[model samples]
Target: MATTSDNQLRNPPLSDQARDRLRAAILEGELKPGDKINIERVAETFGISRTPIREALKALETEGLVQIQANRGAIVEPQVWQEIHHRYRMRSLLEGYAAELSCGKRDKKLIAALQDNWAQVKKAGQAKTVSQNSARSIAELNRSFHRMIWVGSGSMTLVRFLEALDLPQSFNDAFYKEQNARQVVCEHHGAIVDAFIEGDTAKASTLMERHVLDSVDLLASQADDHVSNLCC
Candidate 1:
């Protein structure tokens, strides 16, 4: 029997499956930023042919998760400062809009829910030894708060756009662990919520932008000093 060629065996659907799995590893930091991905090894691990792995990696490269380097093959793209700045800049704008819309909503029930979750996040952040559970729990609480704000915007399109942004779970974990970030996040997020509750659309928008930018700065400063420490 003749063996199949890569062109014959590799299909778009197979590539997508491979891409999703690899993307998860990258986002979860299992692959780690700046780490070289052994495509052959990945293929073997996933029980797929090299063709699928290649296709998957190429797709991820387009998504900014992986990069093709000269003589080095594919690497899990590091959270480069330029890229970080660009992303946060865009996020700041979007989140500010979300807050502005949320303020218009004046959803008392939503505001109350957000306040409750924000408090939980703050309490967890203050714990002496921030365990994996505490860190992840805080992350989830933070996600909820932001999602609530987005939903309150009453625009499914905006919510989907915000959701489509490339926010890594690893990045979130690392960010919360950064110096002063925990303290700042609690205050920043609370202020945004308060602004929304008070029906201050302008203030809410301002706070959201500031909060996003502050996180960008904190992440940059900390990542520069301890990339591996924060990322893992």
Candidate 2:
């Protein structure tokens, strides 16, 4: 448990900021898998104390971005390619079911909103030349597309729990940071949008599953390469 002075808690919104900063660091590969994070160094860099750092780290732990040990403080957990593949399987099964349900339940307005969101993603990718940073924009759009289906499924608890999985920080980070990941994800995004527009639940479900599986395959194949390049 983390105890905080009233003054410290009230003084700065350190927890939220630190959480964001730490998440960015992890996703950006600045903090590689299995890297230990020094609490004192983080506190000093951020100009706060360990109280907020601990709080922020707790949030990261919940998202599977970091680990806390009784003996060791904060460390980035090692990512098992196999485990990541399993998670994609879970997302595809659940999200595909949600998408199928959404096809029957979604209103025209919801469909239109999804189209508009994809348009923005397409434009952003083109305008930015589709670098690693640009890939994040498309990943966010991809989340929005699937999230709409989750919302339309009318299962609040399931949707909330899925949201808690933090797929963006986990799965999205793996795809978006790779140099070629941008182009590959962009191609998949187009395919997914087309499937949605056609309102073919079968097509949508199959495409979604393949999209996720293919992404995991691509990332896993390059995992060792990423580790070597990024863990310096």
Task: Give lDDT for model 2.
Answer: 0.69
Locate the minimum summed-lDDT window of 10 residues in model 2. Answer: 223-232
Evaluate residue 170 in candidate 2 and report its C-alpha lDDT on the 0 to 100 scale.
46
lDDT of 1 by residue, 1-232 (tens): 9976787656437787788777756544467678888877787778889898889889888877788899988887886345657777888899899999988888889888988988888888886567666777787788888888888889898898888774656557656664477889899988987887789999999999999888777765564453222121
Top-TM-score structure, candidate number: 1
Cα lDDT listed for each candidate:
0.77, 0.69
TM-score of 1: 0.74
- What are the per-residue Cα lDDT tens digits for candidate 2 across 31-124? 7778888888888878889899899999888877788988877788777334456667887777777767666564677778777876776566
Off by over 4 Å in 1: 1-56, 69-71, 75-79, 225-232
TM-score for each predicted model, relative to the true structure: 0.74, 0.69
Error of 2 at 147 (Å): 2.4
Model 1: per-residue Cα lDDT at residue 111? 83
